[model samples]
Target: MGGTGGVALAGGGAWVGSTVAAQPAAAAAEAAIGGLTTPPAYAPSGRRPKYRRATWSQQFQTSHGWNAGGTGTASANANDTSVFVRGTQSVRVTTNGTGKQSYVRRTGMTAQNMTGKMIRLVFRVDDVANLSKLVFYMGSGSLANYFSWTFHAHSTTAANYVQSGEWVTVHLQWADVTSAAGTYSISAAGSPSTKTGFTDMSFAVYDNAGGPVTYRLQAVELVPDTATVFPKGVVSITFDDSHKSIHDLARPVMDSYGYSGTVYNIADAIGTGSFLTVGQMRSMQDFSGWEMAGHSYANATHTASYPKLTAEQADDDFRKLREWLVGNGFSSEHFAYPHGAFQKTSDGVPVDLIASRHFTTARSIISETIESFAPAMPYRLKALTGINDGSGIGGTALSKVTGAGGRLDRCVNSGDWLILCLHKVVEGTPATSTEIGKAGLTALMKAIDDRGIPVLTVEEAMASYT
Candidate 1:
């Protein structure tokens, strides 16, 4: 699980790793992801930007002699043919129970500074039956200092993690990785900003299924940094939970920049507590060109997790929420999972399957990175953590909004999409991870304006790009 902010929003998390012995090759399946052949869009028509080869790369075609760690319950096998994104084999790891930390480790590598580099992983989850989470780590010798990120495996909110038997490509920025969860902890000196030099790395996956669950890794690489500038890029500014402060504080700043964002409104929270009233939403939608999207149905406090509901209950909730939004004269084509939790029900029904019945797209707080224009998984649309006033793994300082700006810059440089998630906006100072101060919001809007990046509503982006 990623680090959650106040209420339902979150900050940071990382991924999984493992190693296995070589076995006889199996037939390679044709690549299911079509975006790979799409030439890197970060360069000009005639000129190609050069990217230094990966400081370390593994194809998993044969045994890399990496060390495996975790309880005896977990194991990995290489040269597996059943699932792969490239080549004829991948490393498959099977495990049961949560926090088992099943992984393969590669140590004694030449030290490399990963300041501006990106971690690239190609993996697949074929069964969501008992899966809970995936975690990855990098540290120095003797496993003393390190940082890691977690990926939710049980969530049906993300398309890539669904049991669709498709390989997904994920590129994680150095800044997005954190040691928020997992049995192994990240020390202050182990954080990404402070710990750039590394001698070892590993990937691990944990399951809550009680039975067996498996995930396959085709490749892992550390792509070196390069100067990039794509011909075009787009950003979608989003406010979740329908907080009244969004209308009272954030809107004006964004409007001044000629921007319009999407608001994910809890159906039952309108006009109650600190949430936006129906009239306010309408004004923001019609007068400000904002899009009103669906969130949880009966979440009056706007803190409910949909995955906790029974499949029948969740389906009814989605239906009623969409109906309420459309009946109130707001677009219901887009949605955001409450608390960023869209894991499947105990019966193995993915929340996305239900969401697709009501909304065209459902956003999830999966990571902090630029989303692909052609998202491999639309329902579980990946997003950066909420923007806030604190300083740490997931907070942005009000005095310097460059962190937010850097994300926009990455989108522009790669011709990708950036979906920024925020919860509430308030006056003076923000007191929680779920809230950003007015000054912080204004500075972020200014950063977007200065970059000259096109700002689109969720519906607009999907209609135009997907």
Candidate 2:
């Protein structure tokens, strides 16, 4: 990599690479997740901006890729740093006593989309007494377009603080980018320093310790906050039909454990006498664990499966439901098929193409458990079995939902999404065929939560991958 003072400004088109291939959890997975897991509670962490790595070592680059620049002397900080996690080398820099004026930078990172994402830069100062401030950036335009600023905990007061000594991981969350592409302020830390709304095209590490200090850029990695953000495999628990059992029985249990589930609501059923009322639907947000997505504007009246709905009907129903939910303050563009079925239009078209046009994902359970490598196929996401497959009766064992010892654990080990599908959560007994009792549902969610995998709404699960 060569350091040429400034970058060659490219058009906004490079951002496409950084755009996440957002597939719906089981819509691709809904069809598949018939399952999703319950996420674990975040450990204690405050002040530090918490986040999870959307990516890590696989994308972590070497400091050798960086270019030398500034009054400071920059080189492969190889002598001082150690190779960790995927054979990557670190950069070492010796500052020239001038803060911010000295920096080692690397340009051309079109995939570093910092929009709703966070990037972590981990490093250590050989001498904490001498070096104090650190800055990591992403932007090819100019210093103003940078993303990360200060990693020191002393204050957001942008630099002149001491957080040195051991290996420190600094995280930067991108708020809104400045309207003027090239405008940014290397302002104080505590004060908001927002800029760079575009895709990251370059990265740079600056020494603002205020003097000549040598520091090792051990790793510039993306780390997720164990709190709020998830670390590994994903899960989603989907409750179809806005069933009263979901709000009454499931909600309390999920909330008590700090977990959440997705509820696919049928628009026409809102405010009905027996189903979730409009007030109840709106109030579901209070639990903060349930995601209300679209089931169908009007509940399925006939034996029509996905293909039964014409393109126009699918579009209208899905679109209207999403709009209605959003208008009612629900966050969703996800959907669920009335029957656990996926199909193609009459002329050999995957009916789910219509979902891609209107919803994020549409759900169906093509198989008992999803293929680990196949979660990305948004429209055909496979589902796991709640009751033993091939049996239509309720007397079957609820092994999938309850995990049956290590069943859910095996899925997590293989990195598969165990999208658990269930109908109602009853008290003493399951009210219907596919419904799980309260204790069974709680135990199922608990088992998944114990595994430490993230439980995402179907849509949230897809975003986690993309």
Best by lDDT: 1
* TM-score per candidate: 0.60, 0.48
Weakest ten-residue segment in model 2 by summed lDDT: 8-17
> What are the lDDT figures for the candidates, one per model?
0.62, 0.50
Candidate 1 Cα outliers beyond 4 Å, as residue runs: 1-122, 125-214, 218-232, 300-302, 390-405
Model 2 per-residue lDDT tens digits across residues 74-191: 4444333232222344556666654554455655544443323345454545554445345455554544555454433232322111233323333443321112224544322112
Error of 1 at 235 (Å): 1.8
The per-residue C-alpha lDDT of model 1 at residue 200 equals 72
Task: Look at candidate 1 and tell me the lDDT of residue 261.
Answer: 90
- State in Å the error of residue 164, model 2: 61
**lDDT at position 44, candidate 1:** 15
